[model samples]
Target: MTTTVNQVMTSYYDAYNSEDPDRLAAVLDDSVILRSAAGTGQGLPGYLDTYRTMITTFVDRMTPQRIEADGDTATVSIVNTLTARADVPDFMGMKLKAGETLTLNLRGRYKVRDGRISEIDIELA
Candidate 1:
């Protein structure tokens, strides 16, 4: 059985909320690529580091407001509320420290292949 792109994204949010490494890896493919304003990462290791930062620095929540899918690709509009528990390093060129909180409007474009996320691009709005 294969999952839809939306399903993959839902699992991604769930994994992030849970802060479980294994669960995070389970939602992606071996060849996944993650791109954002901060940097680009190829494969699981690359993505894992980004997730690690979130796991360590901030207690965050990603809420999807809109989702549009066609075939193997999808676009998601999201609201991310983040509260820093530690000094978060160089996020989009800014340094964030504990006690800082912000809500960001962001979008993510996803590509799914074989029931796993193959690629994702995130941008701020």
Candidate 2:
């Protein structure tokens, strides 16, 4: 398969939204680092643990508004729909009540290495 930065990003989101850690891992380097408002995770195991928490804590979906790629780097602007699960954790400086939902604009900057994601940094919009 031909691997492009866009393809890598699509794969990353596809795997993430599907809640498939194994597939998600396929697009990341073993030394990958993910940083966000939530927290930071390093390497494959750290990422999987973080994903597990997300799967358990919230039902979230991402809508990409823009994708820009240059060389092995890419940036995506996205709208996120987030709904708290029954047992949700605190986020965005607020305690989530049951069934509470939020819509947020976010951005993700990524770097690719050998057709895999080497780093991702997320920021609020």
Candidate 3:
């Protein structure tokens, strides 16, 4: 398939925008791997599950600020403001409480295969 970088990126964003794990899964390769500034995971599903759990933990809404793609890769820059619903350990291991909004700048990179992401690397920007 002649999948362009833009198409793959659009699929990835659509999956995230929908917040549907199944939809996200549809665009992930079975053997996908992910590495973040926080940590790394073995597969795409596991990576998605971890973030989903975090969203349930203390995040209210997440928004993307920008996205860029070239060849078989894409990068999404995001500004995420999260409200702590309960005391949770952040990346810095601080105790955060409800109603506290933590703003973070993040960059995520995707490696695509057949219009699906087979690997990802994320970092704090």
Report the error of model 1 at residue 121, Å: 0.3
Query: Against the true structure, what is each candidate's TM-score?
Result: 0.89, 0.91, 0.80
Residue lDDT tens for model 1, 50-86: 8887767888888889889999998999999888898
Candidate 2 Cα RMSD (Å): 1.5
Task: Report residue 88 deviation for candidate 3 (angstroms).
Answer: 1.7
- lDDT of candidate 2? 0.86
Q: In candidate 2, which residue pairs get closer than 3 Å at backbone N, Cα or C atoms, i.e. clash? A: none
Candidate 3: where are CA atoms >4 Å away? 1-3, 60-62, 89-91
In candidate 1, position 42 carries an lDDT of 95
Model 1 alpha-carbon drift over 4 Å, by segment: 88-90, 93-95
Candidate lDDT scores, in order, read: 0.85, 0.86, 0.75
Using TM-score as the measure, name the better of candidate 1 and candidate 3. Answer: 1
| Candidate 3 lDDT by residue in tens digits, 1-125 | 68787777777766765657788788888888989756779886687787687667765444667778777778888776678877776645666776677788888888888777888887789
Full-model lDDT, candidate 3: 0.75
Candidate 3 TM-score, true structure as reference: 0.80
